[model samples]
Target: MVRDQREIPVRDRLLLAGVQLLEKAGGGDVSTRAVCDLAGVQAPTLYHHFGSKEGLLDAVVSHGFRQFLAARRDQASASADPIEEIRQGWDIHVEFGLQHPASYAHIYGRVERGKRCGVVAEVEAMLLQALAPAARQGRLAVTPADAAAEVLAASSGVILTLITQPEDAVDPGLSTRVRDAILDSITTGSTSPVSSGGEVTTASAAIALASTLEDAPTVLNDAETALLRDWLGRIASPASSGARI
Candidate 1:
């Protein structure tokens, strides 16, 4: 098997070596020579395959994120409740970081706002999918996009903070507290479309009616219905405090 690895393409060997280093280092960085030595490849071979150290790091990060998403995909498929599944996702995300801090940090610890990563975007897309069923049912307080953004920010921040501290010194409730609070702000606690209020939440009411209108015949034409749906979305939006449907 070791000889088989040595015979594989240089890029694959480099990724395997980098992942091994990340596991051993616990979020610390490695030198180019270390990766080259682990792969039994020359420095020129590494550079030729990856262009630069940063490029190799990017590939390694993408690889780790892909594996993370794959596990999440299997879990999601076996579950029926979207809201509960979303909460479970938060826990899974934190657990992954604890298990592989170095690989996880490369994917989420950075503070770059404008940069684009396809793997990271896929994670957010999955979150949106989890939230979609609730949103369609008028159980979401905010748009799926807004809720996803909040979840991503809070979960990543909590993991990064935990990884920065000694494992035993970290607060046990921090991740759950942050996750639940953010979720409450975006979704009704129950699967029911309505909140504790008399009928339904204002946002949910508007959203439900809009969806009903979409399904049934209406006096409004296509253009009017489209505009009305847009207006309902804005009213349901958390950022639009004064908006009316």
Candidate 2:
């Protein structure tokens, strides 16, 4: 059936503006008038495009998820190894969170609870599909769906911590550390040998190494530093065995 495309651009602009405002002022500050003003459209036009403020927010969330999923899918498609694909997907997710913190948060953050947007289900399905090959190849220890869910959820926490916490408060290698910890947790028998000095565990060392990668530096802006430290503080203390390294 033929469909009407009358307000596509207007709707897109409103959604984009909503995302920007939501990031700057938060979800509660998002209103039809605000989004309309940001988009340079009138309130009536916004209503014409989106039935209500909630509808506009939903569209914004869905659009953000679509873009995020597409970027990850593209990155995975470019790589042949399933493990590398998964790693790249995580990297893309982190990049997205860092670059578009508001949009990413809108999709996965606390605001998503009552909204119940369908994007989460869609993204989850895509993630599960991506991990299927690894599970089938015995590269990942858990079921494909379970592994995907765990990795996705853990990555979300890592990204949120990185964005929300202050940089100086966290170890310089926080992101790398979290990534390695997650990787090790998901892959059975993939643990690295422990260090003798014990100044840091194997997982921590791996995180340090990962952070030093030419691309992933240890440097952080003031805000990032604060966020990092806060995130580190929130992590549970090491067990008597001291974190599986």
Candidate 3:
């Protein structure tokens, strides 16, 4: 049974209105008047709640995107393989984009120079969390932060490509191929004891040590840990040690 929209809170009603309008418009621009009319609230109410139309849209997109991720994260079973977890994350992101192109575009497509939405950081944080175990296991070829950046770049690019193409023309395997290529570049399959070349590079050693120390408790105090991290940073620097890849 469909509950009455009147029962919903004012703010949520506006959000739902905005989302509905965006979907109905096929990701096109949604007018503030339409949103307010759909929500059955005055224009002043929207401004009072969200400051402006863009603010309302941003809130809707952010809330919906985060909620989807949280639900999926909770539903997923724990996996011993962090790499597999990252792969699953990639799939979830692509699935969200394909299923909700309008919402996905609202998050990714609208960009201003030198400005990034908080949702971008949220996405990166999710990937970073997935990468932490891989880093701790010394499977990451670069720092976890770098790995997350690469993964986000590739995943977003693939999603945008797929979303923009005609549905019938979209390549089914594009996302998988790109994801594998990016992951292969940023990760390795061995512990810090030995990489593919049979010797652990200094950068890999520093990354593994830093990852391990960052997550687990240590004998050193906070300041000492900071200093150790600084040293590790220097060790991992491409200038000090040749570039990782």
lDDT of 1 by residue, 37-68 (tens): 99998999888988876578778877787687
**Candidate 3 Cα outliers beyond 4 Å, as residue runs:** 1-4, 70-77, 191-199, 238-245
Clash count list over all predictions: 0, 14, 0
Q: What is the TM-score of each candidate against the true structure?
A: 0.74, 0.59, 0.85
Give the RMSD in angstroms, all C-alphas superposed, for model 3.
Answer: 3.3
Tens-place lDDT per residue, model 2, 1-245, is 65343445776778778888877864244667778787888888877887777678767777776777676666555765666677777777777777777666666565534665555566677777676554434344444555678877787787788877776674436666776777666554432222223234333433333223323545687677667644433332233113543
lDDT of 3 by residue, 105-145 (tens): 77777789988776777889988888887776667778889
lDDT of all predictions? 0.75, 0.61, 0.83
lDDT of the structure predicted as candidate 3: 0.83
Give the higher-lDDT candidate: 1 or 3: 3
